[model samples]
Target: MGERIASWFAAGHRPLPWRAPDFPAWGVLVSEFMLQQTPVARVIPRLEEWLARWPTPADLAAVPPGEAVRAWDRLGYPRRALNLHAASVAITERHGGIVPSDVDELLALPGVGPYTARAVAAFAYGSRVPVVDVNVRRVLARAVRGVGEPGPARTNEEHALTEALLPADPARARLTNAGTMELGQTVCTARAPRCDSCPIADACAWRAAGYPAYTGPAAPRQKPYAGSDREVRGRILRELRANELPVPRDRIAQLWTDADQLERALRGLVADGLVEIGDGGFRLPMH
Candidate 1:
C-alpha cells in the first residue's frame, strides 16, 4: 500500500498553496476549516484573502466571530467559520497563539474534531498521523477495501481501517495521507471515476469487484435554499455583515416575506452567535 501511494504521489500531486514549504500552521488550519464541505476552487480565493488579513491565530482571534462569518462568504456552512473563530481564540489564550501539535490539544480546541486534529498535527507539525477525511475514506474504500464509497460520514471502523494503512514512518505517513487525498479528489471521484489512469487501479478492489454500481440507498440530499429558512438566515447575515450600526427589525423584515419563518431564522442566527441584539435591534459583531 505504501509503495502504491508513493508512486501516485510521485506521478500526481496537486499544487495547493497550503502544501508549500513556507505555509504556516495558521494557514493550514484556515485551509482545513475553509475546505470543510466546500470545494477547493471556491476555497482558494477566500483562503488567500483570509490569510492575508489574519496571518496568525492571534490575528484571527482578535476579530469578532461575526466578522469571521462575514468573511466566510457563501461557504454554505457558516457555523464552521464561527467554530474556527472560537478555535482561534482558544489557540491564542491556551496555546500562546500557536496551533498546538498534540492531537489531544488540537481536539480540545473548538471544532477540531478527530480528522481535523490529526490533519493539523500531521500536516502542520510533521507528525505521523492518518488524515481520514471523506475523500481519503472513499479512495481507501475503493482501492484497498474493495467497497463502494464509505458511508455518509466518518465512523470508528473507517478511522481504524485508515490508521492501519498509514505508513509506520512519519514522513511516509504524511505522503500517504496526501497521496490518498489526491487520488480520491482527482481519479477516484464520486461519479465517473477515472480508473484507467489511477496508479493503484491494478490493486483496487472495487475494479476487481467488476466496478459494481452503487446500488444501495444514496445519501439524502440537503434541502434546497430557494425558500428555506437557511436562505433567510443568509440574507439577514449579509445585511448585518455589511452594516455597521444595529439594523432595525424593519430593515430585516424587508429581506423576506415569510414573517414566521424569517423570525425563526433570525432567532436561530442570534442563538448561533452570528448576530447579536442590542439597542432594540440586531447587529454584526462590532469588531
Candidate 2:
C-alpha cells in the first residue's frame, strides 16, 4: 500500500510550497496550522504571504501576538492565530529559533497535538513516525478495514496501523506518510472517491467488499454560522482588526442587535486573549 501510494504521489501530488526539500520547518509548521479546517486553495495564498512577511519563527516572535491575529485575517478560527504566535514564541525562546525535530518537544508547544507533532517529525525531520490525519484515517478505513468512513476520532489502533504501514527507511517512511495523506485528500475523498484512479484500487478491501456503507456513529455536525456567537465574535474581530484604535462599545453594539449574544462573544474573545477591553472600548490584544 505504501509503495503504490508513494508512486502515485510522486506522479500526481500537488506542488505545494511546504513540500519542497528546502522549505523551512517553520513554514511546514505554519502550513499545518493554516490547513486545519481550511481548504488548500484558501490557505495557499495566505500561507505564501504569511511566510514572506515572517520568514522565521523568531521573526514572528518579535512581533506582538495581536499582529499575528490581525494577519490571520478571515481564517474562521482566530484562536489558531494566537496558538501559532504562542508556538512561535516557544520555538524562539526554548528551541533557539528552530522547530523541534523531537515529537515530544513539538507536542509541548502550544496547539501542537499528536497529529501535528508526528507530521513535523516525519515530514520536516524525516522521522520514521506515522503521520495520521483525518484523511489518512479515512483512507485506512476504506482500503484496509473495508469501511466507507473512519471512526469519529483517531484511535490508538489507527496510530498502530499507520505505524505498521510505514517503511523501515526513515526517508521512505516520510514519503509514504505524505503519499498516503495526498492520496486520501485528492482521490479517496469522502463524498466522491475516484476508486478507478487510485493506485491501490485493485487491492482495496472496501472496493472488493462492494464499498459497504458506514454504519458507525456519525461525525458531529458543525453549528450554523449565522446568528451564532461565533458569527458575532468574527464580526467584532473584523471591526477590531480594521481599526488602529479601540472600537467603541456602541459601535460594536451596532454590528449585532442581540445584546446578549454580542456580550457573550466579546467575553469569550477576551477570555481567549484575542481581544482586549480598554478605556470603555475593545481592540485586538496588544501582546
Candidate 3:
C-alpha cells in the first residue's frame, strides 16, 4: 500500500512552492501554520501575501505582535498569528533565525505542537516523523484498520498507528507524508470518498469490509457563528486590524450590538495576545 501510494504521488504530485528544492524552513513553517484548518487554495494567496511582507522568521520577529495579528487577515484563528509571531521571535533569538530541524526543538516553538513539529521536521529537514493530522488519521483508519472513520485523533493510538506505516527511507517517508495528506484531501475524503480512484483502494481493509456504515457515535454539533462571543471577537479584531493605532472602545462598540459580549470578546483577545490594553483603549502589541 505504501509503495502504491508513493507511486501515485511520484506520478501526479502538485507543484506547490514549499515542495521545491531549497525551500526555506520559514516557508515550510508558514505553510504548515496557515494550512491549519484553512484549505490549501485559500492558504496559497495568504501565504504569498505573508512571504511578500515578511520573508523570514527574523523579518517577522522584527515586527510587533499586533502587526502579525492584523496581517493574519480573515483567517478565523487570529491567535495563530500571535502564536506564529511568538514562535518567530523564539526562532530568531534561540536558533539564529533558522527553523530548527530537530523535532524536540521544533516542538518547543510556541504554536508548534506534535503535528506541526513533525511536519516541519519531515518536510523542511527531511526527517522521518509521522505527520498525522486528522486527514491522515482518517485515511489510515480506513486503509489499515478497516474502520469507517477514526475517532478524534488526539490519541496515543492514532500516533502509533500512523508512525508504524512510515518507510525507513527518509525520502520515502517525506513522500509518504505528502501522499497521505494529498490522498486524504483529494480521494479518501470524509464524505463521498473516491475509492475507485484511490491508489491503495484494492488494499484498503475498510472497503474489503464491505464499507460498512459507521456505527460509532455521531460528531458533536458545532456552535453557530451568529450571536456567539466568537463572532463579536472577530468583529472587534477586524476593526482593530484595519487601524494602525489604538481603536477607541466606542468605535469597537459600534461594530457589535451587544455591549457586554463585545467587552468580553475584547478581553478574550487581550488574553489571547492578539490585543493589548492601554491608555485609552486597545491596540496591537509593540515589537
Candidate 4:
C-alpha cells in the first residue's frame, strides 16, 4: 500500500512550492501553519506572498507581530498569523533562526502541536516519523482498520499504527507520509471517496467490507459565518488592515450593530493579541 501510494504521488501530486527539494525549512514551517484549517488553494498565493515578504524567521521576527496578522489577509483564522509570528520569534531567538528538526523542539514552538511538530520533522527534516493529519487518519482508518472514518482527534494507537506502516528508510517514510495525505485529500475523501481511483482500493478494508456506516464520534460541524461574531471580527480586522492609522471606535462600531457581541469580539481579539485599544482607538498590535 505504501509503495503504491508513493508511486501515485510521484505521478500526480501537485507541485506545491514547499514540497520542492530546495524549499527552505522555514518556508515549510510557514506552509504547515497556513495549511491548518485552511484550503490548499487559498493558502498557496498567501503563502507565496508571505515567503516573498519575509524569506526567513529572522526577517519575520524583525517586524511587529501584528504585521503577520495583516499579511495573513483573509486566511479566516487570523490567530494563525499571530501564532506563526510567535513561532518565528521563538525560532529566531532560541534556535538561531533555524526551524528545529527534532519533534520535541518543534513542539515547544508557540502554537505548534503534536501533529504539526511531527509534520515538520518528517517533511522538512526527512525524519522517519509518522505525520498524521485528518486526511492521513481517515485513509488509515479505512484502508487498514476497516473503519468508515477515524476518530474526531488523533490517538496514540493511530500514531503507532502509522509508524508501524512506515517504511524503514527515512526518505521512503517521508514519501509515504506525503503520499498518504495526498491520497486522502484527492481520492479517499471524507465524503464520496473515489475508491475506484485509489491506488490501494483493491486492498482497502472499508471497500471490501462494502463501506459500512461510520459509528464513531463525528467531526464537529463548523458554525455559520453570517451574522456571527467571527464575521464582525473579520470586518473589524479588515477595516484595520486597510488603514495605516488606528481606526476610530465609531468606525468599528458601524460595522456591527450588536454592541454586546461586537464588544465581546473586540475583547477576544485584544486578549488574543490581534488587536490593540489605546489613545489611538483600535488597531493591529504594534511591537
- Winner on lDDT between 2 and 4 is 2
Give the TM-score comparing model 1 with the true structure, all chains together.
0.94
lDDT of each: 0.84, 0.90, 0.86, 0.89
Off by over 4 Å in 2: none
The parts of candidate 4 lying over 4 Å away from their true place are none
- Each model's TM-score? 0.94, 0.97, 0.96, 0.97
lDDT of 1 by residue, 1-287 (tens): 75678567866578899877568988999999888788999999999999999999899888888788889988877889999999999999999999999999999999888888888888888887778887887887787777786756647777777777778888778887778888888888988789888887888899999987666555567888889988999899889878878899999999999999999999998888788899888987554
lDDT of 3 by residue, 172-259 (tens): 8788888898899889999989998999988899999999888876556669988998888888888887787788878887997778
TM-score of 2: 0.97
lDDT of 2 by residue, 159-197 (tens): 998888877888778788999999899889989999988
Ten contiguous residues with the weakest lDDT in model 2: 3-12
Name the candidate that leads on lDDT: 2
Instruction: List ranges where model 1 is wrong by over 4 Å.
Output: 215-217
Ranking by lDDT: 2, 4, 3, 1
- Deviation from native of the Cα of residue 285 in model 2, angstroms: 0.9
lDDT of 2 at 188: 94
